[model samples]
Target: MSTKELINNIDSFVSTDVWSPLDPYKDEKIIFQKGDGAYIWDINGKRYVDFINGKGSILLGHNDSDINQLLIESISNKSSTVTGPHQYIVALSEIILRDLKRDHYKIAYFSTGTEAVKASVNMVRMASKKSIILSSGYHGWDPLWYHDNGPHELNKNDILDVFFVPDLLKRAITNNKGNIAAFVISPDYVYLSEKTYNELFSICREHEIYIICDDVKQGYRYRSGNSLEMVGERADLYVFAKGLSNGNRLSCVVGPEQVMEFSRDFTYTSYYELLPYISALGTLKKMRNQNGYMQIRNIGATFLNNLREILKNSPIDMNVNGNGNLFQFVFPNDEIEEKFYRLCLLNGLLFFNGDNQCPNLAITNEVYDFVLKVITQVIEQLSSNYNTGSFSINDERRFISAWRQMDGASDFIDTSDRLIIINKLFSE
Candidate 1:
């Protein structure tokens, strides 16, 4: 179906406050019909490699046979929720506690990452008896952290103290003093030096402020010896989602007894749901039995190292950042990024301009080799056309002919400011 007709029969074309629809190649939207392993087929049956992986949720890949089998069993057995506790939930909680090596921490269930984050903040507030929460990194869609995204201007929630920058965190802590509740953080995408990490932790500890480690996106991927691990010391509370059920809709907040007891008074979805619990249990088992987390970590490391090698001698002024499991390229200009995406899409590859490349277990050596080949071709083509004065970004044939003199003029454009910004944001 046409994009217009598809949206016309469903929802309006207007973008929501929190999310704008992704712009496919040539501004045309695509609706995917099916997926298997690391590939997805569009409605027209055209296949493309899927590196997005459902925003990093499907670590095991699309339509994973093992997970699907479990799901089917649950459905056929008529296993469902009844608004009461389930024995499987207790088992799932135990699995999380054991895997995280947090024997003293309690787990509270939620249906989504945002809900878990909100719950984590509330828990810190209740335990600390403080109103302000110092935060860094994106913490999901809710009035608490994300109001809007306008680069120079983002609408922050007015109800709470949620600071975006590290400097602002220090200032807020000073302004609030003892009124600071927690210092929430996500370390997956954001690059903070060891000095910054230590400084932030020390400041929080000095003021007796609670620490909430938002691990929704990085939990399972950073596991060591069957336990989830991060770069720094453990926090008082940890919010987990996304990688837990490998795309299943389940999230959680885990913390110590004193802080988690507040969950009794907090209204949340009951943990009696059977399907998500089954998914969680099965996913955790797969990870543990196959040592899937470690495997994934190794896979990511391999990809990153290989990517660095591939781009090392290239003329493209780009740098990769983020942890081994999640990384992105820092480009010099949005137009360059847009062109890169278009090129990859036309060549049976998918590339999003969001600056994150999340790999899944489906990224085998063969799959990665194909990806590298495509990337090499894209980069080579770009480099060849850089100073040739033969390429035109515009699609209008008449305009392109008229503006032939402008070709390669873009090469003279200075992008020093953009490079400076990238370095400032990611080099720390």
Candidate 2:
């Protein structure tokens, strides 16, 4: 079908245009047809290097052969989902525990990262007998920690108190001491300084608060051995999803037996469909054998280092954020950045979502070289325009603020209700 036909069909059945705001151009959205390795093809047969990488879930690349083979083999063998329990689930749990280098922790499964977060919230509140939660970063759309408060802020009466710095955490804990059950955080992709993390660890421990590490985004990419290890601390409960199964719909919570036992009666998801578990087993096995984590880090570092070197002599002010696995480009001005995005797209590169690049293990030298060439070309054009004073900002439509935590353009745009805020800011 044509793009218009596909849009019409979708509009007929789809109730919500939930992803409308993520369109970089704020115009037509491309319908992806297929993905292989580090690239994807849209319905129009146009190909683009998939730097978003399934929003950081496709760590091994799209349609990875080993994972696909496992799924195919399982489906062919009629691996039916049993109602009560399954060996594959147990095996996935075992692999998680083994890879995380933790023993004596029980594991529970769910179908999505949000479900896993919900489960973590339930587990902590029950275990600690507290009703309040303190959180930082995005922990999925579960109502426990998130409130629909006009996009920029959380509800004032929310049971969850969010903080960006360690001092705020300390203050919040002091103000709501006995009611706070857990401190939830996700720093696998974002920046959480070691000092701040240690303080969070120290404060939570002193107050008898459980620290829930929401590792849904970082999980396997951060490392097979506990993501918290990189920050020099561990949490009471770690919720994992995304890259765990390389695009499989599976998530799990791993914690001590005492903490996880509260979830015995809380098990409420039919995620034991078996296919995702099998995929998880295969993906984890392959990641271990190949040291995929280090490989991704190396790839990201190499790309960023080369990018820095290439732009060193250029007049454009640029900076890079994130670690070796996931990073974003920061341009000197919003106009330049916007034009750069358009130029990249016009030149057959999909530099959308503000140049956030999440490289997977499949990013070969050739693939990265192509990416570098595109970027260099764009940068050269941007530099020429900058020198000539020809670059003009056209549209200022920004990405939705809710996607700020995951999106790279977040730094360049406001997260609040823009219209309301602008009206309020400059009211005559």
- All models, RMSD in angstroms: 8.1, 5.0
Each candidate: how many clashes? Answer: 0, 0
C-alpha-based local distance difference test score of model 1: 0.67
Q: What are the per-residue Cα lDDT tens digits for candidate 1 across 143-224?
A: 6664343222223542332322344456666766777778877653234345555666777787788888777777776573
What tens digits encode model 2's per-residue C-alpha lDDT throughout 1-428? 77889877877889976443246654656677899998888888888787777677788989998889888888898876756678887787777888766778988888888888878888888887887777777776655554445322335534444433465577778778678888888763343457667877898899889888888887778688467788788888898888788887888898989889988876655655888888888888888899988888887788778888887766666556676777766654567767877677666566546634678888887888888899899888878766634433222333222124442112233323433433342343
List ranges where model 2 is wrong by over 4 Å: 18-22, 147-157, 188-190, 387-403, 406-428
Q: What is the TM-score of each candidate against the true structure?
A: 0.82, 0.86
- Candidate maximizing lDDT: 2
**Candidate 1, residue 5: CA error in Å?**
2.4
